[model samples]
Target chain A: MQGLTAHFGGITWAFVLDLFTDYGLFLVSALGLYVLMSAGQVSLGHAGMVGIASYSAAVLAVKFHVPFWLSLPLTGCIGMVAGMVYCYLLGWRLSGFYLAIGTFAFGEMMINIWLTSDYLGGAIGFSGIPLLARWPVLLIVLPPIFYALWRIEHSRIGLAFRAIRDNETVAGSMGINVARTKLMAWMIGGFITGLGGCLHAHRVTVITPTEFGIYTSVTMLLAILMGGLRTFWGTVLGAAVIYFGPWLTTTSEPRDRLMFYAALIVILMILRPQGLLASRAAR
Target chain B: MAEYLFEQFLIGISTGAIYAIVAIGYNLVFGVMNVLNLSHGAVMMVGSFGVLLLFYLGIDNFWLAVAFGIALALVTGLLVERIAVRPLKGNWWNIKVATLGAAMFLENFVTRLTDGRPMPYPRPFKPVYYTIVGDFEVSNVQLFLIACSLGLMVAMMLFLRHTTPGKAIRVVAQNPDLAQCVGVNVQQTMVLGFALSAALAGCAGILNAVTFGSTYPFVGQFLGLKGLVILIVAGIGNVRGCLIVALVLGVLESFSVVAGGSQYRDLVAYSALVLTLLVRPHGLFGEEGRTGREI
Candidate 1:
């Protein structure tokens, strides 16, 4: 009995550590997507977050030899500023379908640039990135970030975000300053996502543009929406499922994994159209 | 030098027309439903693959294969509407993401079937380059692509203007409930709209395949993405704008390739989109007030 319990405990703890590193980074990135979606923007361009941050961090770490400690937070700041600029310059004027297309185009364009720019290693991807991030880095960074996102979700700005999401005309009439509120959401989301990107870059010794494409964006969105778009806890559940679900369901086939994910999304959307935990829109 | 430029322009316009047709497909669906069908791109690939399938089954006539291909695309588009879309009705965000899943499914399914390889597509015309002037050459295939796209656009416009079903589609676009009250059969109109849109995508796919002289499972990704870009840049529901913008983008891309190499051709289109978002938030030809901000 002792032997079985110890083995079980060992397996559980190991899985949890793996979860904190791999899934935790995804959660941080996903939280950025969550905030953006909360404002009803529905951007497909967000893969740029991972692309921009990971490459920047990788470049800074390898070329400039910036200490790992410095590069991580720097990437977040860069992402925040970049996000705000994109929102302010490009996003402020658009909404609905146009915004989706614009963002999608932007994301594709970045991928194109990544594929062509030989300076950034081109299609071969940037490799030999210092794998500085581990369990501790995520451990320290995650709790506070999770708390911050939760508070932001419930804050006055967060309330305005919900209002805008529920109905923009009403939210505007109620004086939500829809554009500025959206900007804030983008900035915060960008920052967190950038942090995730930096950690992710350091987690793997190589970085490829494929990691930051439409599928990644969709995958992040899936996690958030599936967990229930309204709460951080649901996001945690979503992160958990995405990490663990594949273990039970996925076969050795490579492309089949994407098919599995797409099928899962379709099935989930059909079963729980409002999301797993979504109930009445919070009053 | 001028001849070379002219040759490039001719090439650009033909490809642009192909894009215009694809955008028209998206415009039809978006106009009527206000939902962007993410699977539109995959369906374009479906059209090409559909024709390829017919060819495999011993269909020797190129035109006949095309007919079957368009039919296949129409079916797939309708299925997207029925399965990925309708069940998540009125939930705009859910519909968008679900359709995205549909796109992924189609792209990957084809990827698996073909092992992600580019397959050679059959062309209807023999290789024949026509010289309009000294060294200003145009291929018979280019002329056919240009003519068919223009012909299809004109036909679609006429259909929308003159036909009862097209009018019903217009009415639904204007207001589904009002159209339904007037006995327009809103659901049927929407299905028809999906069919027409998907058919157009089918046509565009074949045109693109013939342009490249081959097709691949992933070809739809770029083709479909370009369609959406042109759709917005041209302004929603503005058919004329779609033609003009798509042609201009195609021309610009052709020039950019000459100036900055083919690897950077996409920069032109995406930069244009970002610039449009910045300078003309309502799109180049879109109406001024509909920034989509309202609930």
Candidate 2:
């Protein structure tokens, strides 16, 4: 068995484990974004929620000495509340590019707050986080999350999201409560993203404010765009590509890597705007 | 205390002038094309680099370097329109995302070329300070920035109001299909709009480099968004409102720095943006029911 695994470019078991954990995190966040996009809303601020939860959970673990199991759910609840409050207060009023900018501002605000606060470890990043999120934990956690998301996607609410995405006025005319449905999308997306953050914090054993900035938000967006936004499996495929595609094309020069990512986005936007795994019904 | 306040206010006005100039270009592109040029900031960075490259090549004339940079930016703008905007023209979301990709490409390309180091801008014009009042001083650069920005704004106003092609741009902005039906050369006008917007961005880049005495690959990242914020505050397509709102934002940012220190400056600015969007979604000068429409 070892020889058989070695034949695949001599990749180590540990590297494979790391890849799985990374995919788990990316998949959760990508799905978080997919939920919003399905409702015809784009948030350039999903990273803020991730950052908030990461910091909250990391603080609880490192400072309060709370156990991982309790801290994780508490972190998720914090994210849920923050997301709901933000959406109810601000997100409901904006749409399109206005919403994009609004969310972008929110993301920046989170980063700035993180950077300025010493309690969150500021620019140096919070460290000494226990690595509780192993491959087994991820394997165990992902299935239920996936099942729940799958259920949500096929539910009546999912139909409402699609209706809102297609046309808000028409959706309103069709008796869909656009505001409440969007609010639900935000809350659900936030909780999932927060869960991803918790997994990331424990898996990586360190968390930084910069880790959850506009760049990460944009990457999450790219994953959804590349995967095809309409389906769950597409998001999984996108998360896979987003995580491994760059690793597969690892270059010695960091500049080349950035260029490669940028080129991929540009080419993808030009050639396959609907993404690699667009739904058949979309066309 | 009063002297400090005066100084900060002066600084705010100068910074706001820079924002205004950049916001004007951003607003122009949005008005004519109805597509947010997310790459506008990256284009401005390219312009700054263009000037730096010229200076390295022994070009000491500031005006010459500025002209070269503006021309380079114009070309870049035209290319972006061709590649990112024109192809995805009626698809609003696609256009926004494509421009974002273009921005990422330009920023990374420059970062790669420059090796991510801050380049010192060539100080062609010497700083001359004058005492305005009791312990209040103003530099020649500040005055020049304000004067140049206002001059450009006036020139743009005249161009749009008087010239035939300028009028054609306005017509196209009003209704592209109508303009095309009336034989206004919609394609050329779109290109021209991009060129004009980019030229303004280039000018702002030169001014910013001079004012800050440095340029970097990511300089435009935040400033571009700030310009957009200024536009939003001023109303999407209103040139006069853009100028006023940019100044207000600049002053507000400066005051926030004085009140809460520099770290809170961005927090204050963005918070103000959220507040503005909430309180006056149509903007200070935007028409009602026209808040979210294509400019």
Q: What local lDDT score does residue A252 receive in model 1, on the 0 to 100 scale? A: 52
CA-based DockQ, model 1: 0.54
Model 1 ranges off by over 4 Å:
A1-20, A112-119, A172-180, A241-247, A280-283, B293-295
Q: Worst lDDT window (10 residues) for model 2 chain B? A: B286-295
- Say which candidate scores most in lDDT: 1
- Candidates in order have lDDT scores of 0.83, 0.82
DockQ (Cα-based) per candidate? Answer: 0.54, 0.53
Best-fitting candidate, scored by DockQ: 1
> What tens digits encode model 2's per-residue C-alpha lDDT throughout A1-283?
7644444565778989888778887787678778888787788777877888888888889999999888877887887887797787567887766676677777788888888899888878899999898878878778988898889889999899888877888999999998899989888877877787887888878787778877788888878877876787778888787787776655656677766776676677777767789854562
Determine which window of 10 residues in candidate 2 chain A has minimal summed lDDT: A1-10
Q: Candidate 1: TM-score?
A: 0.92
